[model samples]
Target chain A: MKHYREPSIEAAETGKPSRKGLVFLAGLTLLFSSCRLDMHDQPKYESYEASEFFADGQASRIPPEGTIPQGGLRQGELLYTGKMDGGDSELFPFPITQDTLVRGQDRYNIYCSPCHDKVGTGRGIIVRRGMKQPPSFHIARLREAPPGYFFDVMTNGFGAMFSYSSRVQPRDRWAIAAYIRALQLSQNASYGDVSEEDLEKLEEAATE
Target chain B: MAQLFHPNINILIRILVGVVVVLAAGLGLAYYQGYYSVYFSQVNVFREQPVMFSHKHHVNGLGIDCRYCHTSVEVSSSAGIPPTHTCMGCHSQVWTEAPILEPVRESYRTGTPLQWVRVHDLPDFVYFNHSIHVKKGVGCTTCHGQVDQMPLMMQVNTLFMGWCLECHRNPEDYVRPREEVFSVSWVPPSNQKELGRRLVEEYQIKSRTNCSSCHR
Candidate 1:
């Protein structure tokens, strides 16, 4: 049987184990340790990853036309279109609860506050920058505008404002309209509009 | 073996062994640190993009909401990149002929999508969702760093598994109020530990340290 150190010259000559083979093996281990990315970056494409396969460097291709995504088939005429019988409906498709109003406020701040301002006065940062100034919700014309009119304006573009159909969902558009009604009420409120309990507090403050 | 070791060889051998041990330890430390350094981890590195979009200008200067451009961030896995139309929405009226905005104009004109280079690319095997993180009270700035301060977007953390495990094991260290999630300059209050603890319980943040929590 051949000895364990059969391959080394020094082992063959002197019978003493040589360190050369061990050193070479250690070097090989070190060389190979730093180089395996086989599982790190796979061949699959993420949402907006670049692709060499297509002429347009995009891995995410637009679905072929007539291909509706799940939930794309919109139901409810008033809900999706904000219209009923070929005209904007005055009533909300869903009831406007306090929660819906709060959701509307949150969405409004994110989407509309840039141009409409927090108080719905139309003098927002975007307007101050250069864009055309939108009419205030407190104006008499807008004050009397039905909820569906605001919904239609948001669903389709109004004068200088672009349609927010892409940025905001249909339900959110109605919620925003509800909030606009809330805003118009807040802005145009008079002494007669105040409740008896709230009026007592206002009366106390007014007297002070 | 006449004098295999001189009488003083004992001290020489001890000193030589000490030196070897110190050298080995030094090499080991260098290897460990080099392996995890930002250079290797892809941290704080800036990559060139087709358009030099600045978060500072859009976020801090203009005070535009993060949702304005990243519309699907709250609902989708991806914080949606603004299409050319979204850009043209403002630029059409704001800076009609600025040289810097020429690429935006061209893309809008030609209907070609502008290719944006991704900054926070995780390893393909790890699954991350923007909606889940944002919903669970992880502020955008928590993982994204002070994005409002970045002129050109750059990766802030190492994005290593070990770093992720630190948060996964204890979420109270980073959780915040849900309402303040999109706030660009949110400073953790002095009582963050207590506030964060309450938020973790309220938000139902599971200390998801299992391999599949992110690996899947």
Candidate 2:
């Protein structure tokens, strides 16, 4: 206490603070500022950064064997695997209504249209840009291919095509497959496929 | 000391010292005020990247959707960065021999990923889910600003916790129709508050103010 008060008392009496004391205080402040070792630089693991703690040296740990996360118990065959017990299912897992078709169309336009093209002609912008052109949906082979086949392709991926499992959900995959079927029908359908009223409308449209 | 300073000189010296102190205080106040400003925060600062990719060229000129490159934004936590194949898809045909595209070509040739520098990086602790925000009908322009207009992608928002809470406090002001989620030029329609209220209920959007919502 005496040492602390001595300097200020001396300064007041002398009308000037000692330069030595000022220099010492400034040096102490500089040292304290420079010696910042805080929680910011504390030992912590960042995502995907190397870790010495883990034996494998990876910060990310693999999930335990047979561990299924919440809502991840994908039990049903058609729902999860896009196939029946034996092979690709002939029927859709759920009913495909007009709304479902619309959803499918929207999702397809967003995800599939990049490579499959709007009309499924296999000449999408990416294909034109130099990526390998996928087989057109209008092709007889693909037209005859079951809906499950398309689902499997989207789920498992085929050739250069990457699996869209993460991007497109299971139901949306079916929708996309339905849209592909619709595209196939649009290209391959004959005049007989049109209803009489629609035929007349088409004829009138052609005439006009 | 043989009269080192005259009385007037000493007075002038004291006045100058006072002025310096006042000026320093004024400067400190200005710095504090500008701490979160565009200049200090680097809000519109164009960050340089390995490749001089132009968002304006791809988004505005070519009319490419945001999802074209940032795929899985609707489903994944991250807006997925385009793989080398995606770049090669166009550059292979258009900029086949341009030296500017040499890095892209090299990536394609070697199958090594391009190291794109991230611009709008949040703190490590902040848990952000792109899908949840997109699904909740928040438009891309809400947080990202007019990215389509920028030639170089610059972080427009301050992205501070307070900035995030401003929206989370009342999401209706920012929420849009599902179709308008990706529309960069979308503005609130006339009945925005009403529509937003309806949507908040319909979508079950309870903007969680709990710190753990983002912190964990």
Which candidate ranks first by lDDT, i.e. highest?
1
Docking class of 1: medium
Model 2 regions more than 4 Å off: A1-89, A97-99, A128-135, A155-166, A185-208, B1-21, B37-39, B61-64, B83-112, B190-194, B204-213
What lDDT score is found at residue B74 in candidate 1?
A: 92
Model 2 TM-score is 0.69
Q: Give the per-residue Cα lDDT of candidate 2 at A131.
A: 62
- lDDT value, residue B42 of candidate 2: 73
- Which stretch of 10 consecutive residues in model 1 chain B shows the poorest summed lDDT? B38-47
Q: Each candidate's iRMS in angstroms?
A: 1.3, 4.5
Candidate 1 interface RMSD to the true structure? 1.3
DockQ for candidate 1: 0.60
Please name the candidate that would achieve the greatest TM-score relative to the true structure.
1
Candidate 1 to truth, TM: 0.86
Which candidate has the highest DockQ of all?
1
lDDT of 2 by residue, A59-127 (tens): 557799999989888888887777886788878899989888898898888778877888999887767
* Runs with alpha carbons beyond 4 Å of true place in candidate 1: A1-34, A196-208, B1-24
